[model samples]
Target: MAAANDLRRGMAIKYNGNAAIVLEVHHRTPGNLRAFVQAIIRYINTGKSADVRFGSTDKVELVDIERKQLEFSYKDHNGYHFMDPETYDTVTLQENLIGEGRDYLVENLSVQVLYAEGKPVQIEMPASVNLKVVESAEGLRGDTASNVTKPAKLETGKTI
Candidate 1:
């Protein structure tokens, strides 16, 4: 258990009977009123976000979360797969769980996965990834006047 004032971004807590991660937190004190903490939390199960307020002294249930670096193996009918390099074990995650990071996934790419109570909760992609262009279009002649850009397909089937 922890006080509401101690809540910080990326901290996992049990809220509303579900495991939620703190997305944002702000401590506010209104004129002639006591200080309170306002937070935005994202639920791990439903992938829904909510705004909640709590008194500064309120008690909150903190969850134990673990983060691991795993390598992207492949995706198939089961789901997106990642391998633990140390143990050579693979874990398959669903497409929804991968979220926007799927666009950046490539073979042997390193990614961080967050687990709560031994269950995977979230995936964190690196700040940036470099991918090889598999297909691209030829630039038209005299089309470089403005900041023009062309779409290119990466080896992972993502277009940019």
Candidate 2:
């Protein structure tokens, strides 16, 4: 157990008998009222989010979390597959859990997957990824105007 005041973003905790990941936290104190902790948490199983408040001295049950570096293998109708580099074991994740991160996914890209109580809960993406530009229109000659932009299709099928 840990004090609510120690809560931080990305921490996993058991709230109301459900495992949730803390998305945000703020410590607020009114002029004359007791200080409290405000937090936004997302439930792991239902993918639902809720705002919760706790007193500064409140005790919160902290759940153990594990992170693993996995390499993206491929995606098919079976969902997204990843491989553990050390053990050579493949793990499949659902599309909803991946969310917008799918746009940046590329074969063999390394990413961090977080697990709480032995269940996968979140995916951590790298700050930047290099992708091949599969399609782009040729710029007009002498059109060297500043701030010029064009649509580009990446190898992952994402258009920018």
**TM-score per model over all chains:** 0.75, 0.79
* C-alpha lDDT score of every prediction, in listed order: 0.91, 0.93
Across 62-151, the per-residue lDDT of candidate 2 in tens digits comes to: 999999999999999999999999999999999866767999999999999999978787788899999999999888788887767889
**How do the residues 1-160 of candidate 1 rate in per-residue lDDT, one tens digit apiece?**
9999999987899998999988789999999999999999988888788999999999999999999999999999999999999999999998866878998899999999988878787788999999889999999999988987999999888888
Query: Any runs in candidate 2 off by more than 4 Å, and if so which?
Result: 1-6, 24-38, 54-59
Worst lDDT 10-window in candidate 1: 114-123
Error of 1 at 142 (Å): 1.8
Q: How large an RMSD does model 2 have?
A: 2.9
Per-residue lDDT value at 114 in model 1 = 88
Best by lDDT: 2
